[model samples]
Target chain A: MTTYYTKSHEWIRLDGEEATVGITAHASEELGELVFVEAKDEGTEVAAGDTAAVVESVKAASDIYAPVAGTLSGFNTKLSDEPTLVGSDAEGEGWIYKMTVSNPDDLKGLLTAEQYKSL
Target chain B: MSDTLHQTPLHALNLELGAKMVPFAGYEMPIQYKAGLMAEHLHTRSSAGLFDVSHMGQLRIAAKSGDVRDAALALETLIPADYAALGVHRQRYGLLTNDEGGIRDDLMVANMGQDLFVVVNASCKHQDADLIEKALGDRCIVTRHFDRALIALQGPEAQNALTSLCPAAADMKFMDAIETELAGVSVTLSRSGYTGEDGYEIGIAAKDAETVARALLAQPQILPIGLGARDSLRLEAGLCLYGNDIDPTTTPIEASLAWAIQKARREGGSREGGYPGADIVLRQAREGVSRKRVGLMAEGRAPVRAGAKLFADAEGTKEIGVVTSGAFGPTVNAPVAMGYVATEFADVDTALFAELRGKFVPVHVRAMPFVAPGFKR
Candidate 1:
């Protein structure tokens, strides 16, 4: 599966009409250990660039903005129980929420795995 | 990244762990790991957290063959802790003082056999070293262990986790130091920690530090925690940090640290009491102190962080004191802190106000250890 990254350190995986999303390895690295992840409720409507989650660490709190507008289809509720999963597999199982893209074109502004590596 | 802050050997590791680096005591230290303050705090209560305290200054107080005990006693006169009473393989918390009865810095002292192992705050290392040297120059040898590593493993699972790296650690008691190999690195390991949790502070050679650190990280429940969590964890445990909670302007009596003073020393007849500030300290022990350190709990999400002005309200209208350490209590899930207030407001349940952003935020005197300390001791 082709994985993409956002400047904010989120990753979006497009699986046809449905998509999977989580923080990128870089974001997890930047955020440190994920202590708290307040994910957007399933079915919550969010615009591109809208804050969809709140990630807090022992030192500070940060907002996780949506890379593309969409209604969050589902969230990885398990994060509430095991926040460290974000640190272990931030790009894979650490995915925060799933959403339907409002415009797939919005993904163009984001970075590819290679592009993120370059940045 | 700031030049003003000194970076430790693990600075790059902090970046690898996604630590939020902050300038502290002239060094760049991790304030928090990936987990935000609250979760990191919760994890500390339930599990173990790894803290890189390498920034703290490590020093040794040595006495040639015959003068060890006397030198130790001379050092004890300044700080009010019972050192001679301390058993071998044990440790004690100590405070350094000035000519007047004022605190210099709070430090941890351990008997490392033939010498004394001391750890002082990084910010005050220069002054502490100078003070120790000046006080004992002609008497004994005081050397700096600059090229060493100090890591604290604190929490409920601290002992078990650390024991994995050092098998002999299981039999160790709180405040005891044992020479053991940790993750293959030779180190002087002590079963003592600051978070009020069951743990150890490992002192190892500087060159082999990274190897030892990586080995400890390999254990379960051992997460790379930062200074932010370290402060919050200690505060939640009702422990004092040197600069903020205890400084040159404060005394052990006013800081509610009277218990640290030895009874014999207070009596002045013998053991150790000829050092600086003994007069005022003895007087306070005989009489009573006016202002005392107390815990304050503020209501709401916004933290009444450090430096907030505190006042006794209504009938006892007085600009009583200011907060030394205040922050949102992650464990209590509320705002909690400690500060020095007048006798009138020092009582638990006494109503007080914390000036936050130009407004008086109502707070009440609360019992400290906002969360129960789970020290294995």
Candidate 2:
């Protein structure tokens, strides 16, 4: 399994043809407390950098972009009831959704964990 | 991040408490502490929360001839309130009006025996001071108290926390002001606050502000709150933020603040039409305004923010008005907002749609405040 991160603070863990996606901890912290989360529905085809989800805090709302082109398979519906999980565990239990990578070459554009931290 | 931002007397203490400092009204003040905005807001509703409001401008208006009525009448010329009728030790809410009948700023005026004490918004202080000086300087001595620091103790347990410091403060009713001593420092105490909760606003010497704040925070029920929670609290309480809910383009009647205009200043009264914009304001009071401010409750969990346009239909074609102040009200456990709407659509429970994130979200025009106020009176 290879884990990649985007400059916009999205993280993806590639497992064969499928990948799990969520926002990075740094992005969640900057957004403060999360009050609502709206993820894209299953079977939706998304392009890289397309808006995939929305996370709202008490102060403002932020959009989560797709890290790589793929078909969204499922979302973590648990976040709909407990949005703050994103703030507590952004990269783990708070994963936003899973998608099947349409173009494996898209993975090469992502950054390693160390490179993401440096940015 | 600019070095030119002004620092309050409690600036060092806020840093010590791990507060997030942000620029507001030319001052680098705390937006929230380690507890965060939601925690601070909920804590203020259930327990005691201390706020460093020294950034607000405090002024003293005294009569040149030492007559309190002279100063009150002089102030009445600038604002629409009947300050001359304001009894001793009583305070009244007022607004500074321009010649066009628009609100310049909202303020609190207290008849504190020899002088009328005033507090104005921090962002409008300089202009407020200059306007007062230029308008009434000949009849009254307008002295801005930059040497003073203001603190507010708010919440259900606020009285319990404050009474421990000054026993007399607990007896003061809502909108009452008195001189008292706190932590050995002479201070002015008022049984009023911006939050809907029952609380007190204390004024003290700038040198002793940190000491008073420390002493209050030492109490078990009292926690230091910041501006983030302050905004949410006042919004839930249906209070108008000067720059948000009320501004230069909003008149008293248009803002639904006609209650602040006393009978003496209205049409067919003893002292009719002496203040600024009396002709238009008094006429509006009798005939009514074109648009009015109202509270809005979101139909869903999605928060509708300020500047979002309001539409007459769900399809969002006809734009009626725009949201002025909005947030996820922690106490109400939902998204709440206040905005101006056509007077015809301002009735309670009038269905409206707000354009949020490209989709029109259903909203209802509800009567403010979203939460009931807990004033001591």
Best lDDT among the predictions, by candidate number? 2
Could you give the DockQ of candidate 1?
Answer: 0.12
Q: How far is candidate 1 from the true structure (C-alpha RMSD, Å)?
A: 7.5
lDDT digits (tens) for residues B1-377 of candidate 1 = 66766777777777888888888888888887777665777787789888988899988888755545655785785687777766666788888887778899888887776778888888888888888898787776889986677888888888788777789888888888767788888888888878867888988887887787787788877888877778888887889988788888887888988777766566754664665787887787678788888988886554666787888763335689888887656777666789988876788899898886456778899987788766556
DockQ of 2: 0.70
DockQ of each: 0.12, 0.70
Candidate 1 regions with alpha-carbon error over 4 angstroms: A1-119, B314-317
Give a tens-digit lDDT track for model 2, residues B1-377.
89999999999999999999999999999999989899999999999899999999999999999999999999999899999999999999999998889999999999999999999999999999999999998998999996589999999999899888889987889999998899888999999999999999999988999999999999999999989999999999999999999998999999999999898988887888788898999989989999999999998788898999998899999889889999989899899999999988999999999998789999999889989899989
lDDT of 2 by residue, A1-119 (tens): 77899999999998888889999999998888888888777888999998888899887888998999999987888988899999999999999889999988798889999999999
What residue pairs are clashing in model 2?
none
Using TM-score, give the best candidate's number: 2
Q: Count clashing residue pairs in model 2.
A: 0
